[model samples]
Target: MEWTQILTLAAKEFRDRMRNRWVLAVALVFTVFSLVIAYFGGAQQGAVGFRSIEFTIASLVSLVIYLIPLIALLLGFDAIVGERERGSLDLLLSLPITRLELLLGKYLGLAAALTLSTLAGFGLVALLLWQRIDTAGLYHYAGFMLSSVLLGLAFLSLAVLVSVVARDRTRASGLAIALWFFFVLVFDLLLLGVLVGTGGRFGGEAFAWLLLLSPADVFRLLNVFSLDDVRTLYGLASIVPTSLGSPGVMGGVMLAWIALPLVVARWRFK
Candidate 1:
């Protein structure tokens, strides 16, 4: 409710990240990985150079699927718990800001840092691809960048939730990594195991809806379903119905993924 207090806290948090060069480091990592993928993504196909935006995005999607979530998780897993471990949580709580304002400030500051890094990193690639891609390609590539930010924010929200729930930084980090592995690595495999073990009869039509459980999958669908060529390349195109593939629908699901975790975190923190 107190904008000044929240903004002050947020500014402090953001400045800490800047002072420590966390934002710069993450941005550089994204820049290097993206540039490499864009240019050498086709090396295995006996070709090496910047390909079409579609192909570049496809390769980048796989990279973002693995990288962004982990980065976001590590960045935020210790937000509150780290404060507690350093004996600063009580000092922060003694401030005039309400707990809600404090939580929102922390989350917003971290989100801003992540968003800036993502945009700067990928925006550089967008600039490099400007001459190569047409208007349509620009549109698709822009969408990919936006969705990548959302995916990171959603996972960061989960990390904040973990920070609130765990008693210490060590447990918070362990839970954070477990969450990353479960959502990024194990969730889909488990879904597939069930679908395959049951001969697809168990998860036929409802499979697409089930993908909503993992923000990573939702991010994948958001990108893959938009492009016709890339859509076919992904098996989800067949499993995810056209109804669930709408940009608006998938975007809403992603927004929910971002919000629900924060809501739960706030409740638990209270």
Candidate 2:
């Protein structure tokens, strides 16, 4: 792919996204939400003299993991198919640009938009926590936020892939939204079912592999695993060893999911 063409297309799409009020509006709402959640969680939890910043950041991370992924889906669910529905994709594709270039451009542009918004939320949360009180594990909290932000990118890539494959905006939006629900919401319910049916007992590596199949679980594992002492001492769902193959392994799994769907989408688009 030509860097010139890719960057040109990326710039154009970036401008389009910036002009789109929905993107900015969503980001604004999310930023405020982060501030509110962090403040209250810190004030309420830490005032009993517990380190409120830690709980505040942890709660914010869980909220980020779920909502950021959904935002990624909502913003990107119609990237290409929406153009087709509005009767513009044919005209756009008819230009001098190659499909590969279009794919790379749109992905980079849309992903960058999502990244900017996600970082805005993280920045606000970090700022709030930094000013209020001294937290013990600041680096760990930052790690959790950074990891969740990347995981959000993975979700955006998934939505972009879906957008490219669908024939029109409505179908693309429906499928992409469905996928977000399945992976983020329903998949967790399914895991809970398995845990319940088996009496919440984990035997071996198969359980680890099953948990790895879920982007949500991989994310939760990262957020929770870092607090091993917290998990052991608190006993908050620590029984079923989420002791996955380290943070790197989970990161690799999330990245693979992000790449695989786009590769399939490109082939389908071709």
Give the top-scoring candidate (TM-score).
1
The C-alpha stretches of model 2 lying farther than 4 A from their native spots are 42-50, 132-136, 198-205, 229-245
Q: What local lDDT does model 1 show for residue 10? A: 83
What's the number of clashes in each of the models?
Answer: 0, 0
What is candidate 1's TM-score against the reference? 0.98
Model 1, residue 191: C-alpha shift (Å): 0.6
Q: Write the per-residue lDDT of candidate 2 for residues 1-270, one digit (tens) a residue.
A: 688988988888788888976557766867787777755655654543235555655666567767878888887878778777889878878988888888888888887777777667666656655755556566776777677767777888888888988887788888877987898789867867877788767433356567677677777776666765544433445444554636777778888877887888788778
Candidate 1, residue 105: how far the Cα is off, in Å: 0.5
Candidates in order have lDDT scores of 0.92, 0.73
Sequence-dependent TM-score of model 2? 0.85
Model 2: pairs clashing at backbone N, Cα or C within 3 Å? none
Residue 178, candidate 2: Cα error in Å is 1.3
